[model samples]
Target chain A: MTLFQQILTIAICAIGTMTTRFLPFIVFFRGEETPKYIQYLGKALPGAIFGMLIVYCLKNVSVLTYSYGLPELIGIAVTAVLHIWKRKTLLSIAAGTAVYMLLIQFVF
Target chain B: MKIKALKAAFPHTIPILTAFAFLGMAYGLYTRVSGLGFVYPLMMSTAIFGGSLEFVTVTMLLSPFAPVQALLMALLIQARHMFYGIAMLDRYRGMGLKKYYLIFAMCDETFSINCTADIPEDVDRGWFYFFVSLLNQSYWVISAVTGNLLGGFIDLNIQGIDFVMTAMFVVIFLNQWFKEKRHLSSWIGLAVSVLCLIVFGPDSFLIPAMVCIIALLTFLRKPIEGGEDKV
Candidate 1:
């Protein structure tokens, strides 16, 4: 691909992405009242969205393969346990990541 | 106000700082090795700030220049952002012109932090969200450029550093779980996603998972919203 085409391709991606990000706001403009259903969604979706995101991050992990996803499993366990025990977000994440790195790098 | 918001926002983005550094550098290195110049990573990282899509764009760039395919791939991968936009519609209102940038920069990490971070009452919400988005994007763009420029010299044993992202999300999910009275939405999200992943596999399960989640949530809205113990 030519340099121009490459830039165009990137621009196309940018356009597509911006569309998804902006579509909801555009559809539910602020001038009119947002429907009750959408309002409920706006409140309720975050919890599920966060959950979906966690799964999205680990989508490629194969429990059937080598290491059996033990590294990811243990990593999540450490993160969840630390957060539940101490309630420090950064501490939980940093420690969990360190443990996972060690596991994948050596133990696994 | 902006300084205060930045100070408040910076701490929340620390994990993203770590995660993006590795991921962005890897992307830059990938771009460099893919026979592209630093310009590609720089442009793509800035224009297409979404991490996964940017990585895919590198491969797209190497292949035949099918603009339609690139656009469709981007829309498919990024369709989740629509959910973010829906969730953030009210939260992002009344921010004037800054809302545009906020929506534009609402990648996964930014959206996660902005959606869940308990901003103090005195701190300005708009600026706080803005700084989080700005800081996250800065980390990504800078790391991508650095990786592309120094692709050959920076050898580090960071095999599982990517797990920081997963770890961060897990923590965020836990935080949300603790905040809510009911775990119905959270459980639905997890179960439906796992089911979809098993059924459709990873590459194609996300949209289905999202559809099923919305459907289930909509179906059970009575119990979820009525504050009844239906879980």
Candidate 2:
């Protein structure tokens, strides 16, 4: 692609992205009361979104593959246990990541 | 006040700091090794700001020019942000000028942090959100540039390190789990996403999964809001 074409491609990608990000804001503009359904969704969506994100992160892990996703499973388990145990965000994340790194590096 | 917000926000972004520093460098090296100049990664990271699409943009730049395909693919990949914008409407409504930038920088990690973070009452809320967005973007840009400049020389055994992002998400999920009294949405999200991952595969599952999640949530709205399972 030519330099201008590359820039246009990037610009196109940027526009697509910005549209998604801005759509909700524009539709539910200021001074207008947000519809009841969307309001309910706003209240209810975050928890689910967080869950979706968790799954999104592990979407690439396959049970059929070698190691069979054991490392990811173990990592998540450790992260959950630590967070539930200590209630510290960074502690759980770091410990879980460390366990995964160790499993892939040495154990697996 | 801004400094205070930045201080409060920085700790919440600690995991992102680690993940982005490494991932940004990987992206930088990938761009550099693709025979592109450093400017490509630098500009993409700064302008696009979305991690996955920015990586995908590298391929788009390499391929024959097709602005239409690039735009459509970008929309498909980033459609998730629409959910984020909806969820954030109320929180971001009154944030003034910072609101625009917050919306602009609403990548997954930044959205996760700002959405879940319990900003202390004394801290400036708008500034807190702004700094999180700013700091996370800065981390990506800095690491991307560094990776491009220091290509191939800073190799470490970072093989399993990408799990940092996964770990971060898991922690956020757990935090949300503990906070909400009802687990229906959480379970629906996890189950639907996993099912979609199985049915649709990783590369193509997100849009389907998100659609399912929204449909199911809307279906269960009455029970969710009826306070039968209040959080």
Candidate 3:
């Protein structure tokens, strides 16, 4: 792809992505009251997001293979222990990521 | 005067900035390695700010997919953004003219930052929130552009990449879990997802688990909270 083509592609994608985020604001309610659907989404969205995030993180997990499985096990273990013992996000993430990478490179 | 906003906004944004910077670097490295020029990563970061979407876009780009395909793929991967906007309607209504920008910038990090903070009694929450929102977007844009530019010269191994996101999620999840006055919903989420993964196979179980988790949380919330505003 040429420079111009790449530039165009990025522009189109940026517009689309921003539009998705801004759709509700653009299509204003124009009424004083909060819309029913928005209210429903407010009630429902947070828990759903939290759930989706978990599934998202574990998206690559598989039970049969050592390729992704063992590393995930190690990650979960390290996360659980760090969470209980130290309760620091950056530390826990670093520890888990280090374990996962080491396992992926070294261990089965 | 605006510097106050930047200072107020930047501290809360370090975690997000760090994550975006490294991930942006990875994407830029991928861009150069895939035979595209430096501008591609910068432009993509500025444009397609979605986390999963950018990763997916790389594969599509390697194949050099058609424009329509890229558009549809962006929509599908970020289908959740529609919901994110819907939930923000009431909160954003007060932004007046800046409402549209709020919608554009509200990613997972932005939403979490918006939702978690206890807006002080007399503070200019509008400005504070706006600055934070803008700061998040700026961090992403700057990191991506810098990474892409740097990608032109640097050559290094970039394996174990996806786990950066995973590690952050696990860390955030753990942080939320420990501090949660009531851990019922998170525990439900964790258990339900694992069970669904075991039962339905990885391909089909996720959405169902999400739905079930929502249902369970809604029904169980009253008892769990004992009628108090936790967040």
- CA RMSD for every model? 5.8, 5.8, 6.0
lDDT per residue (tens digit) for residues B93-206 in model 3: 677766666777777788878767665555566666787788887777777667667766656444454465566556656665555566565667677887887888755565
* lDDT, residue B3, model 2: 88
- Candidate 2 residue pairs in backbone clash: B181-B231
Candidate 2 lDDT by residue in tens digits, B88-154: 8888988988899999999989999999999999999899999999999999999988887877566
lDDT of 1 at A63: 88
The local distance difference test score of each candidate is: 0.85, 0.82, 0.63
For candidate 1, write residues A31-83 as lDDT tens digits.
46657886677567767877877887788788888989999999999999999
Cα-based lDDT at residue B231, candidate 1: 43
Please give the lDDT score at residue B16 for candidate 1. Answer: 95
Residue B167's C-alpha lDDT in candidate 2?
A: 77
* Alpha-carbon runs more than 4 Å astray in model 1: A1-13, A20-30, B1-45, B48-103, B106-136, B147-151, B228-231
Q: lDDT order of candidates, best first?
A: 1, 2, 3
Q: Score candidate 3 by lDDT.
A: 0.63
**TM-scores, all models, native as reference:** 0.67, 0.67, 0.63
Q: Please give me the DockQ of candidate 1 compared with the native complex.
A: 0.50
Over the stretch A28-85, how does candidate 2's per-residue lDDT look in tens digits?
A: 7764665787667766777777787777677767789799999999999999999999
lDDT of 1 by residue, B1-231 (tens): 999999999999999998888778767876877778888889988888998678768767877788876776688567768878878988999999999999999998999999999999999999999999999999999999998888656686656766766786788789879878888888998899899989998667766887788899899999889863344
Q: lDDT, candidate 3, residue B179? A: 54
Chain B only, TM-score of each candidate = 0.69, 0.69, 0.65
